[model samples]
Target: MMNNAKHYNLSLDKRLADELKSIGFIRAEQDLSMWCGKERSYFSSMRCRGYGLHIGSLTLMAARIADRMNTTADVRERARLRMALNIVNAVVQEKCRLREQELLTA
Candidate 1:
């Protein structure tokens, strides 16, 4: 029973990965026809299709680096380090909550 369940789960995970690969990111097909204009293509003023994604990635990268610097190095003031740690903890807690909800729904 355990072996069969494990195999089924592995196959399910593989199928999901394949599906995601084929579909690509959800924002890859972002439409600007709603508030901007009636167009399926990206805005001419925008740099790329993943600017929003890139912004999120950059924010996370900076937070992780700053947290590490604050903890490992003794450069930041006590108040600043405390605020950074609080932000990190909040993000982690939110992620955990989201995962729990996902698992429950699944």
Candidate 2:
């Protein structure tokens, strides 16, 4: 490959690919827990409640977001990033909701 100033370095690409792969692996595990094992929790037994979407649902949403976030250079990596971002957003939103519930109950 040509090393051009305009091109992203190979190391950066490798780093991103590895990160995306990790996210995919985790998401796949979540899918197994939720869809196959009848469990609603994942990743060291973290509950999936209040996150607005289960793993299956989030994966579907990710597929939709990936359509918009797609890039020519690395469509797959962008999709993984989109999916991970969506999961993070959901977790933050859910935490806020739980905090509000605690305040109201207190």
Residue-level lDDT tens digits of model 2 in 1-106: 2333113222332332344357773444444334223454442243222122233443443454455466535767666557655654454355455446556766
Provide the TM-score for each candidate, comma-separated.
0.32, 0.35
Which residue pairs come into collision in candidate 1?
Answer: none
Scored against the true structure, residue 38 in model 1 reaches a CA lDDT of 23
All candidates' lDDT scores?
0.37, 0.43
Task: Please provide, for model 1 over 1-106, each residue's C-alpha lDDT reduced to its tens digit, 9 standing for 90 to 100.
Answer: 4444334433432332233234431122232111122244433223242221122332453365455556764544544444534443444444444446556766
- Flag regions of model 2 displaced more than 4 Å: 1-22, 25-72
Candidate 1 weakest lDDT stretch, 10 residues: 25-34
Model 1 / residue 86 / CA error / Å:
0.2
